[model samples]
Target chain A: MYQFTIKPLFGTEEWELGSTGVNIAFTNSALWMMITTIVVIAFVQMGTKQQMIPGRWQVAVESLTSFIDNLVQSSIGAQGRKYIPYVFTLFIFILFGNLLGLLPLGVLGVHPFTFTSHFTVTGVLAVISFSIVLLVGFWKHGFKFFTLFVPHGTPIFMAPLIAVVEFISFMVRPFSLALRLFVAMMAGHILLEVLASFVVSGGLAGLGFGAIVSLPSMLLMIVICALELLVAGIQAYVFALLTALYINDAENLH
Target chain B: MPQISQLAETFSSQIVWLLVFFAITYFIVGRGMVPRVMDTMDRRSKQIADDISAAHAAREQADKEEEAWRARENENRARAQALISEAKAEAAAKSEKKIAAAQKRLDKKLEEADERIAASRNDALEEIETVATDATQDIVARLAGIKVAKPAAKSAVKESLANG
Candidate 1:
């Protein structure tokens, strides 16, 4: 179980940057994020160079951009277009992370087998979502953003208790958002890698029946993989939506 | 040295790496990726606007043609109305002539009936006069008066009226 679980192939383990109070290191996830950034930049910059009228690439980019735009508009309003860039970026980043994680080399444990289940990645994402919520909140409403926890339409007597509950709930947003996405992506990858190891382990006896039995598992994994893609998109959408909702609350803070 | 040597991919440490990766993605999106997407969207929208404007121009041209057709239709209707009025006048005149001819025929029939009635009236009066004269002659004969014919009685009546 230990051998199957831990695959140390990459030289990345010795090169962790720093440790915090509770003991968390940020290294591999950082590198991958940088890669995700560079990839996103290259994709957009190149996809629009010639910019043919009816070209497939341009249409695709436009379609995605507009889809998110329309979503924001319908959700909040036309005024929501101001936040389109952040939402769009969130979508693309998660999109690459989930997809690139499924890449063979990425799954194979890079540089002395750095386990990709690093919570540092999760925490970082959570913090950003957290920061954005606060930044946008304070930028627009300052102290008023905190009032969202108290909620509206509540009776005066219940206000204090409800406010405390709302505050806790508000504080949990980053954790829930980051945990949901990271858990989903990481779990799906781990399952796939595990199933792949099974097909390799059970040799000749594994050939006929093992391969046949694993067929259903492989097919199930494929379905899950496809579903994971949707989950990835949705998680990103959820994170952005929450941010927007927070921002809208701030903007409408009275 | 012990701490560095002790570095192995532990279950707990993976959480840290996850956070790091998440942060990178968030930052990349926040800084670089989002702006490019927005620019692409703005450009695409501008293209759509240009398309709509071209369509609007074409629509305007069609509208002008439609207006021209409507004007021509109106002019045709007016001309047709004038022609119809002229025809109606001619028709009315011809109908009046025919009606006058029919009235003349009706007057002639009425005059014929009047003539027939006068002749019948004269005959009835002559008969009545003859009968009255016969009755008076009979009465006079019976009471010392002589009998007279219709013509004689009529002459007597005329003579009496002249003398009176």
Candidate 2:
């Protein structure tokens, strides 16, 4: 099925600028990302008038901003206010990226691409957030930042074991964050694609039994799409919320 | 497996696009939209606070004005009451003087009437005494056929009258 393949929209062509090994290519993922950026920028620009009594668009933007602000403030304390921009950017990008894929572009024979469906994009975001946590930790606490690994009330004998466990847990945070988003998005889309293929194949193959089978499949697809929308929002929120929590741990060492 | 291997092939381009788009969103949202929203919220709250305080001030002013008006009305009422009482007292005093003057004149008239009635009674008694003396004298002359002296008769009459 065409839905199962991740083909480059531009026919696998790479624009090699120089010997520096930087490939500038127009991929589907890049196109979707650019669209996401444009959409976000347009939404922000729509609310630029900033009315005291806000209209619908301004209210939407302000609510999202305040939601993220409160999340950051509650999770990471007042010092986390500075990271709101980064967290907000990550949240909106992932949120729209997930939602954009759910749009009915397959009807037009164009498969929608969600940037978050790939591990590489999410991995980059996770790495950025994880790096911020580590850098802020070490910068604020110096070499004692490693103390974050050891449990506070542990016996000296068990301290070494706990530290190793804690270190491993810390190192796996980025991968887990990346995989959680990537897997959820990819799984939901694939399920939708498979169900859609079944509906199409059944509809084309027969007149009575096959068409009746396609009805339930279509209904199930609808239900799954609705669920995917919720998953999209929740996943974005979870990603930002976890990032804030990690930053809090880094700052507070608990 | 294909998906896993796809990472190496698409990693660079994805990273490039991610960085570019993310930076743009970050700048546009962070630098542009956020501050405007915050400003709108702050301004709205400030406007509400100002409205409430102004309403309170206006209410207080109205209360003070009403209180002052009530005080002035009470003072005016008290002054009117005082004027009414003063007029009542003055009328009472004038009536009392008139009654006193009328009482004094009535007393003088009562004394003059008493003196005149006493004088009249004395005059009537003297006339009756003369008439009785003459009548006694006449009776003695006619019935006894004897001539009596006037002074004697008078003395006899006075003795009889006194004894009776």
Candidate 3:
């Protein structure tokens, strides 16, 4: 639970914004974000060698780029090339944020923070993606973009009802997108924290009790940690995949 | 939890920094690094395509050259065959003319030999007739113990030769 807390890195808990009603602080979350940013830039910049024969790092960078390239191509067809940078940024950013949270730096007395576990962060990302979808939709089709809510072959009489349902589902996309990643990251961390407590408490009780409770809990914890790593990558893929799908809709309108 | 309780204080900072860092990452990784990689890939593919087309052109050129060489060889072979047949016919004609000339010369020589043999046979027959006349006259003179006249003896031999 303490690991989930966002504390100030220096000075007071927060700073006043020159008589404005707003307050801000440089928390561990921001520090980790900056770290993630640096890591991402260095990894990508180093990997981009532009050589005819790529080295290992360059291969890794190319593999990831091609993965997203294929994803966008499959989902959005040719026109999707324009949106690759945005979608790629979203994917790598969220992926690094998720993985950096799971780093085993606790032995070094630095508790890793998962910024992606928060609704605000995920919500902002989702909003950004959704805004792009809306912009592309409106920019391309103008008022006809509203037709997206109606099914392709709906009856005239049933169109209104279908449109209402479709509109609601369409509007839920961003919320679902944001909530899925937030809940997944938060829940896995919570489970691991609980099992860790059991390990500590059961170990303190006795060797026999430790075998019965702590051993199993520790085993389960390890399994869950492995599962969390998979989840981190899957969630990142899902985020990018869904963003491409949404962009596909905006571009193709179907 | 500070997540909910400290939301007001932290949310602004998180959003501000997230936007800041995200923009930086987007500019550096997405805009800058990615295009260079894509351009390299594009250039590589273009080079491969050019190489393939050049290879294809070379193969076609080789095929054409082989075909032309074969055609020239066949034409040369046909010309050589014609030359061989012409030389054979010319040799046959030359040999036939030489044989005919040799046969004509041999026939002329054989005719002259036949004329010569006939003349010699005539001369030999005249000499034998004269000797027979002289022998008949001498035999009559010696048996009869009388001198026979020359003209008489010659007339007697002629009469006897005619009678026989």
**Model 2 chain A worst lDDT run, 10 consecutive residues:** A1-10
What is the DockQ score, from 0 to 1, of model 1? 0.11
lDDT by residue for model 2 over A4-59, one digit each (tens)? Answer: 34556673555655666667576888888889988988887776676878889988
After superposition on all C-alphas, the RMSD of every candidate to the true structure, in Å, is 12.0, 5.4, 5.4
Estimate the TM-score of every prediction. 0.61, 0.78, 0.77
- Give model 2's docking category: acceptable
- Give DockQ: model 3: 0.46
Relative to the true structure, how large is the alpha-carbon lDDT of every model?
A: 0.63, 0.85, 0.88
Off-target runs (Cα >4 Å) in candidate 3 are: A11-14, A198-202, A209-223, B73-164
Q: What local lDDT does model 2 show for residue B91?
A: 99
Ranking by DockQ: 3, 2, 1
lDDT of 3 by residue, B1-164 (tens): 65687787678877777788888888888888887877777787798999999999999999999999999999999999999999999999999999989999999999999999998887876676678767766788789877777778777777877798
Instruction: List the lowest-lDDT window of 10 residues for candidate 1 chain A.
Output: A1-10
Of 1 and 2, the candidate ahead on lDDT is 2
Tell me the tens digit of each residue's lDDT in model 1 across B46-135.
889999999999999999999999999999999999999999999999999999999999999999999999999989877766666676
